[model samples]
Target: MRGEELQELTLEELQHLERTLDVGLSRVIERKEQQIMERLNGLEQKGMQLLETNKKLREKVEELAEKQAVTDHPENVFNEDAHSSESGSLDCDDTSDTSLKLG
Candidate 1:
């Protein structure tokens, strides 16, 4: 079948050999296609899993940010009010000190 001693093969024998080779080639091609499809399916599943994980992580980050904002908002307001009151008292003290110095 490798072109060696092919002169000895009759037309019928060559035809049979050709048919056998064609059947073997078809099986090989079919198996290869099946394996490719399986690999593609595996990769697709992995991609979907990664997407789900990413979505969960994004949601967790957003939740944490919201919690942080809620917790920080009150502190910010408290600090501002505290600073304003302190500054107001300081201003009163400064005015009294200035009046005493002038007198």
Candidate 2:
């Protein structure tokens, strides 16, 4: 209200106006609190989802590591027939020619 209008109001009217404003301010504060609580709940749910995703990713990494370990082991790579070749000797099949042909 303008200064002239506010000056026209009696003491009782000013007290009533104060009470109305207090009620409006309380409602506004309550709505803001509710909004904050909702946002907090959303953030908590997102955090849980991220944790679950991280767990799944970790498990996948471990599984891949185990598979890689089996494939990358020296014994597994060179010993498919379960026999160790003699040192300095070439293990070859008799049916196959060992010489390289030049064209």
Candidate 3:
């Protein structure tokens, strides 16, 4: 039918047309919402994976720092002469002269 002819419908017919349009629009909105939720779920999964990878890298960095501290010690680089006042030299200050008897 022509546009003018369809516009000239009675109020009851117009109400029926409005109800049909509402049903179709509601379905379209529902599908759009479902698609957005699926994309959000995928992003959350990727974020979790990134967090796990960051944690592993942090652990590796800590391990390397410990190894470097042992290999390149401060005493070796400074080249300060160490004098022994107590027997069985331990990593302690002169205030505490007690030696630990380690087997």
**Root-mean-square deviation of each candidate, in angstroms?**
12.5, 10.1, 10.4
Per-residue lDDT tens digits for candidate 1, residues 69-101, read 778655333335445654555323344333322
Q: TM-score, each model?
A: 0.63, 0.65, 0.59
lDDT of 3 by residue, 29-100 (tens): 999999999999999999999999999999999999987977865543322356445545545457844655
lDDT of 2 by residue, 13-65 (tens): 99998888889889999999999999999999999999999999999999999
Residue-level error in angstroms, candidate 2, position 16: 1.4
Worst 10 residues of 2 by lDDT: 74-83
Who is ahead in TM-score, 1 or 3? 1
| CA deviation > 4 Å runs, candidate 3 | 1-6, 74-103
Better of 1 and 2 by TM-score: 2
What lDDT score goes with residue 93 in model 3?
56
lDDT (CA) per prediction: 0.78, 0.80, 0.77
